[model samples]
Target: MNERQFGPELTAEGASFRLWAPAARRVDVLLDKPHALRRGDDGWFSADVAGVKAGARYKFRIDDEIDVPDPASAFQPEDVSGPSEVIDHATYRWRSENWRGRPWPETVMLESHVGTFTRDGTYRAMIDRLDHLKTTGITALELMPVADFAGRRNWGYDGVLWYAPDSAYGRPDDLKALIDEAHLRGLMVFLDVVYNHFGPEGNYLGRYAPAFFTDAQTPWGSAIDYRVKQVRDFAIENALYWLRDYRFDGLRLDAVHAIAEPGETPLLGDLSRAVGKLADTTGRYIHLVLENDDNAAHLLDARQDFPRGKYRAQWNDDYHHAWHVLLTGEAHGYYRDYQHSPLRDIARALGSGFVYQGEASAHRDGRPRGEPSGELVPIAFVSFLQNHDQIGNRALGDRLETSANPRAMEAALAITLLAPMVPMLFMGEEWGSKAPFPFFCDFHGDLAEAVREGRRREFAGAYARYGDEIPDPLEVSTMQSAVLDWLSREQPPGRERLALIRKLLSIRQREIIPRLADAAFGRAHAEDGGLLMADWRLGDGTTLSLTANLSNQDMPLTAAHIKGTLIWGKELTASMAPWAVSWRIG
Candidate 1:
């Protein structure tokens, strides 16, 4: 097993504490007493203390001045700024030892936030909901980042301690139990990890190690200096820590486009390679997915015979944007890029992967976005209509169900679920819950006011229309409003929507998942009237076809010659009804 270069490592005698504080003249491990750490020429301070055991809480004292928690802390029991707890990774006994993980093609992900996923908002609380997900045909549970942040509540993006699972969600063992329970139920667990920038508060690295960040700025904060070897290792090790210790099946790298590593072998490549190496050693089917706005298709090019560093897939935002425009007709922000020809964009996304392949993006001030992604397989793109970013970033944090027509939303669901692309659903999307996933965080004083003002300022139009109604991101009520009403799945409209989703997924698993590995993009086209026709060659050399009329007006089915067994929707006639969708396989 590869031990982490940072934090405390448990030895037979006791524990060895290490800190990479190159800038600090002297460092001390503050346990029951202040034990001085010996600084090496390489700028690493190390102290092997006997009699120190797991559950011991300690902090690092730099130059007898500021005290900081371990950057690689395994557990932050109190919070981000509190003392770091030493955890023995080898202590936890595995219940699902034989679990190797499912193949990537079998992925039907449900992206969830732990805080809002259950009413209790703890890892242990999430275990009770596992059966619901498994029964709904969700093969993968993708969690938002859980790394220790400043407050009791957050979206997880503001994580500063990359290794520590937030104390708010329970202990490290509680998280392991969640993953263990998931694996036992034949569900793979994936974690979202942020490497772009640390959260705005409780980040003390700038005080001790300034080389960790660059002068370049991201939307969040200072860009990480990945060129520095130690900084690079921090990210890579953190990834390994989650997969190895927590037994997570996969990891979704959040916002790689924001990660400013301008080197030949960027952090993405290195991290992927390292993950691949771990998979090779452990004989596990681990996967790495990226959320890259650049639409860098090269990273997902499976044709490359490289043994390591090949990403399994990426979150296809273009797919969501196109559907969002067609469903809601909201031509604001990035939605403007797809509003002009949403149906055509949807067809392109369905058939050839990306809609804006090397095209000028008006939203980005006319700079061309994305590369040619037509050559990649459909499974290389993870498709979803609602995610944390799509819904939570909104001024009101309303779901598509609140704005889109019910019939049209059903059609969109059919397309997203049955298409060859790997599908994902937001937490409460399965039952069509109206709960809003408003962006919420726990910050105080000036920071809270800044976040409140920033949110209102960003959506000034929304504020003008519905001022004060927009949930405050810092308010406890805001987080409470986002909780999934589990009983809704059994209620009127919720039951109907859940049935539709279950039916769609059942068909997908039965018909599509069996032949998705070698599936290739075939062709797609949008007719004059809101009609979309697309087909793909499945792994077994069968054709899967989709015909959808997303517009409010009915349209004549010009390409009605689709000859396949009807998988969903009614048999096509001369004319298709508005919001009608059909899927077939032959």
Candidate 2:
């Protein structure tokens, strides 16, 4: 069959969809309603609902059973395989006339939940929110994964379908419209795509296509079979579809360590090459950002993973973990191994990456990480203080995590924004958002109870830090905790926090300080009290001096070797206090 005939092809009357169900004798288009489809001879059935308009919802009437929505639906409400909707991507009028993708080396990102970013969670509603982000000055926006997850009630993960946009947020056209609008507004949108495995509840792709999944088990479900030709093509094609068809800026791969393919050239490398080709063809910057914990430096090398590191970059979970544990002082689960989060860890992540590269680790069997340097591009790896997992996976799903005193939080923010690396801010982080960003999944009936029990068990093992009172991840309290106080932005504390964040971001975009640009640190001294990361130049250099006071009294700054412009903290200034950070453009 021709390429156009395969998968659902866009048509004058929205998009005409088809599925190969030779096993089934009949199939019908469950268009927003029911419409009997004319089954072709070769298991292909066609349905075109004209005038019904793009972004209109429908479901598949396979024989007589109504399941979930299409796995590849541009939008989903009933999760996966319930109903399918037709969305015309070409219709949205874009506005970002002056948008130029920030070279990743200079990437400064602001992450947000559409619902909490503004009073209204719709795509259009975020437009008003962008002005603040733009003024704050982060060049990019990383949306939490919005692939077709089940229900309108949870995080964008657990997405049953890899293609369909979830109906909970907005329709397909609405997402495209949002992207278009953001482009005009000059914000590059990076969509978090779950490719490691499908979500549990509403997934139904297997019933239609045989061999779509292999026995590769992940934290979620069986992983897609990339070794197989058809599945491989589908995975690659789906990415291409989104980039070329939907015009998205890039795809953020979630939990890439879970991707298991037996082939020589790994599926990840293949995807990277293909995505680059598609990006070239479209004359657009379509990139792949992998969320991997393997601490493999080759993934960042252009020629290592495939044709030189198949992906543009990998998310530095080490950076997140190291910095997070340092800031929160809560070491449970993987955080248990991070004993030394001295300024050196931040500096290494700032300059040469792969912190665990050939290093000994008790958490990972004492094996050294070896070598994680040589990928000499600054800001190639994204660094953040808080993310969905670090913040939401906790019993509280809290952002501030009790350690965010103004002095400490501000210092941490300076480290994140002023370092020689790409910075990402979690939703509501700019204004000290009280939103908890908890783990919220929708599981009805028996599965719901299973989820609750499972969540408790998961946290049970890590109860050493918070003690036994860990709240269940599935609790209603968890979900309610995630709601950001919309009024926080107007309060005095919120205003000050917001001002600090805005100023930091603005400096990241416009200012060029030595610490933000320095590659080598002349000296690094770590003490039980804290560490002083000093960047010394021949004449005058900057030192990103930060201290965290876990102890009762004030911790002193002892870096006299390097000099720079003093920005924050009372050690250097009478106004700031302990647990503070100062940036001097020495």
Q: Could you report the Cα RMSD, in angstroms, for every candidate shown?
A: 1.4, 4.6
Q: lDDT scores for all predictions?
A: 0.91, 0.64
Tens digits of per-residue lDDT for model 2, 180-230: 777776778888887778777776666765477887788777877777665
Evaluated at residue 176, the lDDT of candidate 1 is 96
C-alpha-based local distance difference test score of model 2:
0.64
lDDT of 1: 0.91
Instruction: Give the Cα error of residue 244 in candidate 1, in Å.
Output: 0.6
lDDT of 1 by residue, 238-341 (tens): 98989898989989999999988775479888898888888878889888899999999988954322217768899999999999998887898889999889
* Residue 361 accuracy (lDDT) in model 2: 74
